[model samples]
Target: MWAAAKEYFTHPQMESFKRDVINHMRGLWRTWRSKMNCEHVKNHDNLEDILNDVPEFLIKEDWEWLVKEKFLCKEFKKMSKTNEENRALKTMNQHSGRRPVRQIALDLEEKLGRPPTVAELVFKTYKEGDMIKDDAANERHAKILEIMESNPDFTALEVVEAILGEQKRGHVICFGGGLRPKDLKSSTSTKDATDANLEAQLRRSDEEKEALHQSVIELKGTVSEQAEEMATMKAEMKKLQEMFASSQNRQH
Candidate 1:
């Protein structure tokens, strides 16, 4: 429980509340042994772990304080299982038949006359529905992210254009400026040398297509000329045949 609490304490979202929770708990943790009338944690052996250790059993007063301060969250965060260890833990759970804790958190912040939390930014972003609904489009987006991660030079705009069609370009992305991954951040200048490789590819493909179209038009003109020459040749052959028949009739 203490380990989980420590993890939650370090989480990045809603830092205002989380920091206060940590500071308040720090006092409790510091005086835990004295408060509990106990000098040991985990069989009186783990002495190093004693520093800033939460008591195994919290007392009534502790519970009351947490409640009075509105620090105890009703919905437990489930980011412990996620592999995304570097990012902030999302506090809002999308469960059915439950009041929106996110809204409550926002309201509480407003009531307290505090600024919007990092958690609020996250909630608003999700509310905007940045995720692509189609599984295939999502898979393609993931692949694009992977490619960007590997390359590291591509800006978010380039990545978006590569991953999304023209219609879906702006909709495919919704990351913040600073918090976004290195690949997704649109820095004005990245390192030199094949920067516009994707753009070059698109331009080259278009050029090739135009050339192919021109070749097709030239081929059609050549075919028309061949057909006209064949028609003239057949007319000349008929005239020769008619002249021979007329000569034969005169001889008869």
Candidate 2:
């Protein structure tokens, strides 16, 4: 890879070409590592290993000529479809199509105060349809998912807010609860007094309900005890009356 880079850099018009090639190669390396389920590459240390693995045919004079004359200058360049190049290209394509999960997590954490789990993050970030069909959008969605997963508990609105802070694009309209930009702005504009009062009322209502329930239970118990005491008094009075009537009859 160094040799190829040096050779391209030596040519005056090839500086840009060299840079593009390096970028392409680095992208390929990333793809390869992802396929192998390896962690992120920290540096360019294994660049030589990657280059060495590529066949000598790719570096041939004719191939180099084609790269210099055609691919480097094109805005949307097509990679070679040969086996090795295809493998590398496949990884590259996949990498380009998806966003890094860690970045998504960071974004979520910055906005929502917490990250979401993987499933929650995926749902929050991605669209409802097929990912392959919506590559570019899916890539963005994946990035958002990654952010949420890393910072689980971040609200969707928080994620949207963070995104808005970075880019003024009118995209990312709703975060959660179908909140619109105008709604957020309007709500924020309102006085804090209303919110505080509402919260206090809710608390008071809950406390009142609890107190009322306790009072009813106590009253019921008191009523039941009083009824029992009255019944006992009535029985005692009847017994005394019966005794008095019996004594009067005996005297008669």
Candidate 3:
């Protein structure tokens, strides 16, 4: 895959791009499956017929599994009900339509002198015609205003948490990039701990390497000193033998 690419990318960049692609594909798959459920699975009693009418893109076995195992499951039904309730809470249409809130926020940041607050961005996007869509939104807007006025330094995330409290797992209150605060916090803490562990391991490895290097140097010095001492002892023994031989010759 790296060879196939015309341009070079760092490993981290490649990994990030891969994640983005996988996320996009998953999103597409979910959207397609949801539409299929709405069209074929919901309000349809004939499973065999639905299986027969399976789209060309899906295998018959996969379609059967979806119809029999997934759509018919109790958990799926309960989740569907919960999703419907959540959908009902969306009282206003977003002016930005299908565009992500982050993009809208970026544009707002350019337009305003500084970055716009979440409340300001929400009010700008969540509108119908010329006015606020409903009383619920109006009340939320008022509360956000009150909070911001009281605490001028609070960030968008902070404001959201203040207004809506902690979000449930797998749920975001306001299109806040699909991350629950509690989950994000836990993930961040875990990542930090893992990184710290890796750093400690690397430090220990380096220390061990340095200690081994020092030991090798000391061993070499000891061997050299022992060799020099042995050479001096051999010279002294040779001198003693010569002196003994010379004395024996004189006595003869």
Per TM-score, the best of the predicted structures is 3
The TM-score values for the models, in the order shown, are 0.26, 0.25, 0.58
Q: Per-residue lDDT for 194 in model 2?
A: 22
lDDT of each: 0.44, 0.46, 0.63
How do the residues 79-178 of candidate 3 rate in per-residue lDDT, one tens digit apiece?
8889889888754333367776645655665687555665666787776777677688878888888987887666444566677775456534443343
Off by over 4 Å in 3: 1-12, 89-96, 168-172, 178-252
Candidate 2 per-residue lDDT over residues 94-193, each given as its tens digit: 1122544434434555576644433334443554454434575556556655765675545444454543343133222322211234433433211222
RMSD of each: 29.5, 30.1, 20.0
List the candidate 1 regions with Cα displacement exceeding 4 Å: 1-195
Name the candidate, 1 or 2, with the larger TM-score value: 1
Off by over 4 Å in 2: 1-193
Q: Which candidate should be chosen as best, given lDDT against the real structure?
A: 3
lDDT of 1 by residue, 1-252 (tens): 345565633322334344335654775764552343243333334434433344557665664454333322232123322423523442223321243333443354457565333223223434326554556445564566576667676554454445443323222232321112333344432221112322333454565566567767878999999999999999999999999999999999
Ranking by lDDT: 3, 2, 1
